[model samples]
Target: MAPLSKDPATLATQGKKAMDESKYDEALTLYTAAIDIRPNSPLFYLQRSICHQRLQKGQEAVDDAEIALYLAEKLGKRDLKAQAQLRRGIGYFFLHRLGDALQCLKWSKKLDEKEKSLNLWFPKVEVGLSKLEEGDERANATVPELPDVSDKIAAEKPSTPAPVSNASPAASTAVKQATGVTTPVDKIREEMIQNNTHVTWTLYVKGVPKDKASVIMEPRSFHISFPLANGSEYSIDKDPLFAEIDVDNSRSSVLSTKIELHMKKKVEGKKWLAMEAKEEDVKAEQASAPVNKPAAAPSYPTSSRTGPKNWDTIVTDVNDDEEEGDPVNSLFKTIFKNADDDTKRAMMKSYVESQGTALSTNWEEVGKKKMEVTPPEGMEAKPYEM
Candidate 1:
């Protein structure tokens, strides 16, 4: 085995590279090691949460994302906080919790509307919520209840009824046609066990004649039926399997009283949560699905239309003054340069709003007009002297 690194930063760097290469399991291991070395690092938790999401571990991803969000808030890292919210929302989406998912995604959008991945996820969540609401409304519609029929039905029927047969002629005929067995079949009990390389089904059936029992297996499902001596049928209707199997390699054996079915797994080491996957869940998985490889981080616009219409021009003028080696302008430029993009945009917006006139992008003309109208409070008069 290769040596493990003691430094958390090194481990995290390696983890990111592994994720970029589509090696999610490897990335998860490396991120776990990094977390072990430095438990308080929100970035490590955030990265690991992404790995869990890709692996379809919805609960684990939600837990990790929550931790990352908490740590980011403690450290005052807004960018990381926004990303954590997005991850948490995605986890909820996978779990089919549409309301919770929508809340988180909307919060994340408020924090960073230009996030490209969020742009992709938001619409899907919206559609899911709409569908869920429609379903609820349909279910709530009232249905007419049946009228009382007990008295009329009792008066029409005879007091002494004839003995009922366990198997109706139609049922027996259908069973014979399907399984080539004349015996009556009832409900057969079954249990499924899935492992790394196979799926085994154990069926409890009593007193089935060897010649009468029939078992059929398919890639995604199985069927077994036989007649019991008690005049009842024991059989499994065509039932869906947890996952696809290799039908050619699957076979069944009759023990003294039970039937054992052995099926080779088509995909080794995959964990299945349900006996049958739901159609909606399958479609949701295909929509906004996690990729095997990490996508490049999206670039956000530094300014938006919601900010000052002339924000870009004002910033350029300030930059120009700083380049001319003016001490006051240089000091102002340094302050603005050190601030985050959101803060800078807010500042520009405030200045433009204070002007009380239509905004203009032509900074040279606007700057001259602004200087004449009234110099900004913090700016020195010398800088604006004509």
Candidate 2:
């Protein structure tokens, strides 16, 4: 008789426990074990997707959430299906695919309006959409500010406006002097240097005294101004940076003829072509460079029995210039490279069983009986409050 200890449901229960304790890696391993036991279980995939998201593996989270959605649909699990959609939407949000995230969130909300998680995430999806519409540079500033709904709930008397005062002759004169003040404008030449680690911008202002110059740097913007001849001011003001920078790490230096800004990137290993990058620049780069192409296999002898005979047999030949190479090991390597850790373990288990190999003595009994388990709870998983 087959032991009930290895049931997928029981393993999933243990995975949920680990997740609650913030042991995400252990939870991932347990969930993977459950998935290996029953690949068709939507719950297992959904749990693993959450683990992937917690680990900051956006692509992996997206893949698992998609698989969970498919399985939930096949099983006619409405609640699970809605949760799967929410997971996919969250995954897309993390990937910065705002359009896709909004679409998925809309569908999820339609399917389960009362779902707490859906309600919580709906605003975030809307925020992302708003960001895309307003422009990426100003997106961070576009958070939806909810009006005071409580005031509407209660009746309140309208307040009268304050009376406007006419300016006296002396006050009018002072206002005119303030408004008529003008500063001399100077020609400021700027140069930008950018790389993976940092972005440096320098502005050269001719005929400006070093003592009169001032420079201010913020996380996302900078300002530089100097007094010119005859009390006139030459200024460069409110310029946006390429990306959000470490304000603590950034510094500005004013020399006799120039002001230099050194900005350390918030995200390391990110390449910047310009001192100020827009959403269009990032999109253009992604569109030009595709990620779906399979890596080229290393060269091998055609006659080598252990090596692949034709690479085309393993993965689609993306490079038209290269001739086909070995096929045997190429297919295995391609599949292995593309598969998740759980899928690889499942394949290994099947191979070992087929070979009549003895199971490891140290392998402990995992799943005992089917156990009902709720998804891990999060503080942010509640419905939005006005």
Candidate 3:
């Protein structure tokens, strides 16, 4: 019989299947074949890395995860990139690299909140930090006591539930008094602030069109805000954005804390340069007397529109690719430039798929015990020394 034929996508899918079956070595072989066929496709590397993690090869898992993240970002797959960051964070966590793990998780969290699945894992980080802090405190012969709030709330409330009033005079007056001042629109900022308590700090993106800009949050419940329209506001939950973190007691150690805003002014600057070059080209064409061609219709790439309208949701189907124009390419551009209502849905979907795949794959096997390299040790000499 002829040798079996295998393609990259096939290999990748096979690897994924094997991983699901917990046949990690078989999965690694398939993933390796997939990567050999298509080295730049981050999915293959990410899957292989997952297998490495499962085998307890923390450093190798980190290495592949880093490659996956860099490639994903370069390919404009923000979601996959964020997933890679998360994988890296997990690897770091296993290796006892708390600061690095915190940074990766924080950044990945900033890219998308749904990616905040890592939030539950953060309690582990906190536990590790607590242990370390306790050890340090023990070494120093001092430790702070935990705070309590239960008794204060008990003292404030009498031992009875307040009676519900159906239109009593005092209740009506109270409702009337409150109704005049607090519309839902007026309460948006207040509500956001109240719900955002884990937000130890924020960075405001400045000097961009309010409607055309976006904020990327990191590591769960953290936010980076910017002014939107009117007195109204918009914030990017760190939940979904990729970030790097270095958490310390001082606020100064925060990641991207100074707020490096990549303003639209930068785009305008590029436009200015392009116009200058275009003017020179126009002059050269004029001198060549082919100016009769009416300048070839200005040659700008037409922007394509084929995506959903929501910011927090993304919808995808294979059928979506059949429409005219390159949706993926356009969507990719929109993410780097600015995440608009038109592009936000596709962006979210892209991230969801990319990250979803990365997380579900067998990454932990890379660091698992079965795959570990044990060094050769000398056997007992059968009492010859005696």
Model 1 over residues 121-158: C-alpha lDDT tens digits? 66456545545645553223121111232343233332
Better of 2 and 3 by TM-score: 3
Model 2 TM-score on a 0 to 1 scale: 0.35
- TM-score, candidate 1, is 0.36
- C-alpha lDDT of all candidate models, in order: 0.59, 0.55, 0.45
Model 3 / residue 167 / CA error / Å:
92
In model 2, which regions exceed 4 Å deviation?
1-5, 133-386
Each candidate structure's TM-score, on Cα atoms with residue i matched to residue i, is 0.36, 0.35, 0.35
lDDT of 3 by residue, 279-386 (tens): 354334335432122122211111112322232332233224334333223423333234234333433333333332221112233112111111111111111110
Instruction: Pick the lDDT winner.
Output: 1
Clashing pairs in 1: 184-233, 185-233, 186-233, 186-234
Better of 1 and 3 by lDDT: 1
The lDDT, on a scale of 0 to 1, for candidate 1 is 0.59
Ranking by TM-score: 1, 3, 2
